[model samples]
Target: EEAGEHVLEVEVSLPELAELLGEELRLPAIRPRGREAVLSDVRRYRSIRRTGPESLRHFRRTFRTALRRQIAEGTYEPDRPVVVPRREDRRYRSWRIAEVPQSNAAVIYMMDVSGSMGTEQKEIVRIEAFWIDTWLRSQYRNIEVRYIVHDAAAREVDRHSFFHLRESGGTKISSAYELCSRIVEERYSPMEWNVYPFHFSDGDNWSGGDTRTCMELLREKLLPRVNVFCYGQVKSAYGSGQFKVDLDDELGDDGRVLTSEIPDREGILPSIRTFLGTGR
Candidate 1:
């Protein structure tokens, strides 16, 4: 039983794992439309043997012949003698090298960490971000991700801090946008990077003037450089819920601006698909 189990484990391959993931995720067979094709076929490359026949099938035959020769020579002492294989007894497996294009994407995830963004809203953002990252990774080999969390002010942080940090300061959405624009200008150039900036909030801002400033930043600085700028308004009881409407009224004609309402965790997946499905 142990030997059988060991054999079964050794026989399991990468293709089998890929098939399992495919079935579990129910990922659509859709590939990125224009440049690089999705990975449809998954398999393992076989290694070449250094000794005997070049092919495994041929090597097996040669191995059998060598054993038979030893038996005929009458030098096959079961206890002390051994059989030596010649150079023709080796075999090997073959595979092709697959070259894939590098996708230049920079995802800036900005979120409001004010008192209004409660545990439930944060959970939704976490779930949605995971799916977005997974889908983007599948599509691009070179995906750069940046996380910014804000309350009264905006600051760049690592992934852990972005999702976990909490504050009780007032909301100023424009501050976050300004920080994002600066990051793009200093670190990520529009010509070299395909930018995707996503902001999540409870749709509340400090003032209308700040919101107007946010719009100006998006219009003159962010919108032209990015492939898509997505805004997700997470519903909160404490929130006034006015930012999304303002964005729609101002930037509805811009193809690059995408806005969605994430009422709860259940809406996270669809919202993510809405933001990324365009392959922009």
Candidate 2:
């Protein structure tokens, strides 16, 4: 009976994820809109100087010229082959800064570090975050990533600390939202940058009041500036899982707002697809 009660499990390939993501999310490449152009150092051999380093010598041209000179000057010896290049033969490539404009993007990642959110929940966020970063980077020439973690409070952290952060205290979803809003306003302007702010949690807030604060922040402050606000509510055993419902009720039929329920590690890719699929 146990042998016959088997189920089919499909394995998702990483290469296929990239292909599927491309098909599902057709985000337009952002074009930079700014007066200040980005500077890039480029090497060119357009101008060959009389004296230069050996590295950039025009070997073929120099050899041909030397052969002509040697033959004309009666220095050519067919019996003993020897052709020497003068200092004029040497040419070095010059590098100059080329100013170019490019569309830029920033991804702000926020997560609940509260006790109810366990290791597995954080793991889901980590995996999804990796894929999201890859996809966004592919779409933009310049990409900035910021991480915020919150329990009863929120704080900005480095990438290493952000994913490794452990569960603690109670959840105050508002703190992370508030910080994320500030980052968007200060660093990533709507005109200059294509901003993407993503939040991950177990859908457990300190209270309905804090949830209201989060909603206000999203609706009033964040949504206006960012390209999109993505929220992934990872399932947790100790979590109430009510915040997902709250977001749904408060923010109805909003194209810019995306929310996904990630049940486990396996849900990471699907959650990412749903969040980024809107093509905002």
Candidate 3:
């Protein structure tokens, strides 16, 4: 019984768990034929399987032993059944410990949780952020993630509340930017940390003047101190969708400012790739 339990444990660790996920849902790096690609090729597909090829190597050896035993025992009648497995029949993949470059990255996630931003939008942000965290963690030895949820005012919150809190205050984009700048100044020094500020919103603002203040903060305070500032405008029936256009018109040529649109949950993956693909 003990030996049976050990075998069960070993089987549980196989890559078959990941393989069982449909091709579309599986992480890009572990997909069939994906092993040939370098980490740089799919940095945005951030899910990392904890069990590498080394884990599977043990199973391959065990399978070979089992096959040989079955053949010797005459459980496999080669002549009558026409069963054959040559020395070349055995295939075991080798895994090399990839030397992933160590870079410090700080991602500041700011979300608008005003009346216009609904639970569906928040869920989308939550899912995308999880994948982003996974990918960045794989690449960097040290990663710091800061969450700021904003309405007319903004405050730093823990990871749990960042994705779950529901509030109905008015929208003011600058408050979030200001809070994000303070977090950077206090915790993440730009000299040592590759800062990435990503803000998710429905493009609703309290006023045109507040939008101008947001631009000012990005240009004067945020952009200069970070590697990249990303803004994802989530589409909403109540939103005007003006903030993204404003930022694009103002900072279209600025490499530091990257922007994307998340129309729904389906767009989350591509948006994550767009934001992090630069390795900035």
Which has the greatest lDDT?
Answer: 2
As for lDDT, the candidate ahead, 1 or 3, is 1
Looking at model 1, report the run of 10 residues with the lowest lDDT sum.
1-10
Q: How far off is residue 176 in model 2, in Å?
A: 0.5
Once fitted onto the true fold, the runs of candidate 3 whose alpha carbons sit more than 4 angstroms away are 1-93
Q: Quote model 3's TM-score.
A: 0.70
Q: What lDDT is obtained when candidate 3 is compared to the true structure?
A: 0.73
lDDT per prediction? 0.76, 0.77, 0.73
What is the per-residue lDDT of model 1 for residues 153-180, given as tens digits with 9 covering 90 to 100? 9999999998899999999999999999
Looking at candidate 3, the ten consecutive residues that score lowest on lDDT are: 30-39
Name the regions of candidate 1 deviating beyond 4 angstroms. 1-99
Best by TM-score: 3
TM-score of decoy 2? 0.68
TM-score of each: 0.68, 0.68, 0.70
| Candidate 2 weakest ten by summed lDDT | 1-10
lDDT of 2 by residue, 1-280 (tens): 2223323243444433554567665543334443322544444244445566767565655666777878888997766667876665444444444332356888999999888877788787888888888776655568899999999999999999998888669989999999999988889877778888899998888998989998999999999888878888889898888999999889858887888888888787678777776655
